[model samples]
Target: MDNNAILNVAHLNIKFGGIIALKDINFHVPRASITALIGPNGAGKTTVFNCLTGFYKGGPGSKLTLSSKNKSNNLVEMLGEGFKLQDFINPPAFVKRIYFKMFGGTHLVCRAGLARTFQNNRLFEEMSVVENLLVAQHMSLEKSLLKGVFQTKDYLESQERALDKAHDWLKFFKLDKRANDIAGELPYGEQKRLEIARAMCTSPELLCLDEPAAGLNPAESAELSELIIRLRDEHRISVLIIEHDMHLVMKIADHIVVLNYGEVLFDGTPAEVRNSSKVIDAYLGKE
Candidate 1:
């Protein structure tokens, strides 16, 4: 792995009941840059995301490595032998049949500094808008369960830090005015912004977004683009975005990776992707 690469996906393959969704796909996302993943429907774009984020385990001989720029930790090796779906399901402990294999998936991935947002908004509908951001920052809290139970000084400090961080994000997204409003009660555009702010609260070195512009109107999409650019420029966080909006992708992406039939068809600058015959053929079909 090169020192410059923040994430490396090598020979990733995914299958479901003999249906191969991704075939030997490979790519690298560099640090402090915005990379775009674009493809037509059913091109395995989302499947690639699933593999990278640990939602789906890759097939045999597949590998994914992630490294951070500022940290000495080897996230690639720390991920510990790819993902296993069985590990994500927890069985009854009293039955004496509990399997550790069914209990240890990739929650560690997020802890290792990668975070993502889903294609659809996944907010806590009942929680206040500010609470959504606070929940995401739970990992950074300084207090332990024991400290909270005993009402220790650490618990008070952690509570204050969490609230301050939450307020910062709300203000950053211009949602401070609606901090107490329920997440579901906000307008659709505000909900989308809230999701981004929530992901930011995780303080990930690398952030992955799935079609953030899907349901947004042009104005909303423009705002979304600005927010993403702000993330890259102000926070110095690298981003991998899977989007179908060409205008948004072109405007914000420093590099573009195009996929067709679960394979890389083009990888270059946005202008290069726009001009490539292969990209046009994959998206528009031969004339």
Candidate 2:
């Protein structure tokens, strides 16, 4: 584990029955930096993101470790796989592991201080824009059903904070004016911003963005690059991004990891990646 890293992936391997999606994938996202994951069309970049975010489980010996605020979580281990021998000795640990295995999903990943946007905008189509942001904050809100129903002072306070935070993100993303509009009706660029804002509402220590600038024009991609830098420089959030836009990636990434066919081909600074013969041959191409 890199002490400077917010997340570390090691010996990661995932197979779909007979087909292996990823094999021995390893990388670390340094804290308060932008790290870009780039690869060819079938390089298994999204598969890595899915495993890191708990959408898919890695095979045996896979370790997805996340460190936040001085605490560490082995995401794969948290999935409640069969109890270990050490767990048998600790009855409490056994019970806890079992509970997570039965009830755990992607929510647990969010709770662990990681948030992400999909390759495609996944806004709540029928919901209002603000509603979309609010929903993303649900896990962090007070969950006392009784207190919520009664709207106790604590509950009310929490709700107020959530709303304020939502609006703050909206303003940051310059979407405040469209707060009341239906999310699905927004233009493509605005929808992209809204989705990133919604992910920010989670107050994550690490943010993962998948193809965020996919449909954006050159100007929009440039703006998105600046926003991503702000998220790291101003907000101190670590970022892991998968993007095909080399210009955006090279401009903003503090570090780069190149994947080719589910394997790490290179891991270095942006300049190193640009100069690497293997990367050029595998993905970047001769230029």
Compared with the true structure, all predictions reach lDDT values of 0.83, 0.92
The most accurate candidate by TM-score is 2
Best candidate per lDDT, number? 2
How do the residues 150-258 of candidate 2 rate in per-residue lDDT, one tens digit apiece?
Answer: 9999999989999999999998888999999999999999999999999999889999999999999999999999999999999999999999999999999999999
Model 2 lDDT at residue 175: 94
* Candidate 1 structure quality by residue, lDDT tens digits, 243-279: 9999999999999999888888888998898899999
Please state the error at residue 263 of candidate 2 in Å.
0.5
Native-to-model Cα distance after best TM-score fit, residue 125 in candidate 2, in Å: 0.9
Lowest lDDT 10-residue stretch of candidate 1: 92-101
